[model samples]
Target: MYSRSFNIKKDLAMRNEFAKKALDANPSHPQTNYDYGLALCNEKKFDEALIYINKAIDMDPANKDRFEGFLPLLFMAMRDTENSLKWLLKMSERDSHSRYLGWLSCVYAHIDDLDKASDYLKRFLDERPEIKTLSDYRKVAPAIAKNL
Candidate 1:
């Protein structure tokens, strides 16, 4: 986990260096665009982040995880329910067994859809029943912080 965080940090730094070079030469490169968007997402600059994320997606939507993860979460953080739900459905279809169900629990909670939240919460808990209360949830759950 430490290595993954280190790599994310390292990747961000390397990408920033590369971004400077790209900016000096031409900012139109797809990788530069994507990396800039990824960096912006890491920085929590969602609106600016989305511009480049969409640019990268338009250039090549084949890497669906980029759009689905980075873009949708940006919208979610911004409280843009429309786009968030749209991507949530798409992501759920792509990988229902994934940890994203934990996110779904939060979304449903946010919308005051406790019933659905409870359903997904049950699934999430059932997936790893060891997590029962908020205290235990802090540790027993996966490394990624997602609502259950």
Candidate 2:
């Protein structure tokens, strides 16, 4: 367990370094900013991560909806359910993907809104027949699943 945790930290540090170098080389690049933001998120630096992530979204407004999907989970990790719900609700309305339904369910569950959570969870499962169990859901979204 200790070794696994240490290796995870080391990997995140390496990721942050590489992403920082890439962002420095091309600060205007949307993908580079997004990648560095993701690295910061992996390190649990939520505020700094948002700055880069939002910058990336602003740089490429055409793909804003797609780019913003990660925000709900990031906010969930920060224990900011209000923001998480805000993004999840936004994505649920805009995104065609089924995962947002699952995320919505997870956030609802986290907030003790079981009726809404179950409704979203059912919708998610209906869309994704392959995800038949909590274990299967965890495989696809461990962070969100853990809340359930």
What is each predicted model's overall lDDT from 0 to 1? 0.66, 0.80
- Give the C-alpha lDDT of model 2: 0.80
Q: What TM-score against the true fold does each predicted structure earn? A: 0.72, 0.80
Instruction: Tell me the lDDT of candidate 1.
Output: 0.66
Q: Kindly report which residue pairs in candidate 2 clash with one another.
A: none
TM-score of 2: 0.80
TM-score, predicted candidate 1 vs. hidden true structure = 0.72
Please report how far candidate 2 places residue 13 from its true position, in Å.
Answer: 2.9
Tell me how far the alpha carbon of residue 61 in candidate 1 is from the true structure, in angstroms, after superposition.
2.8
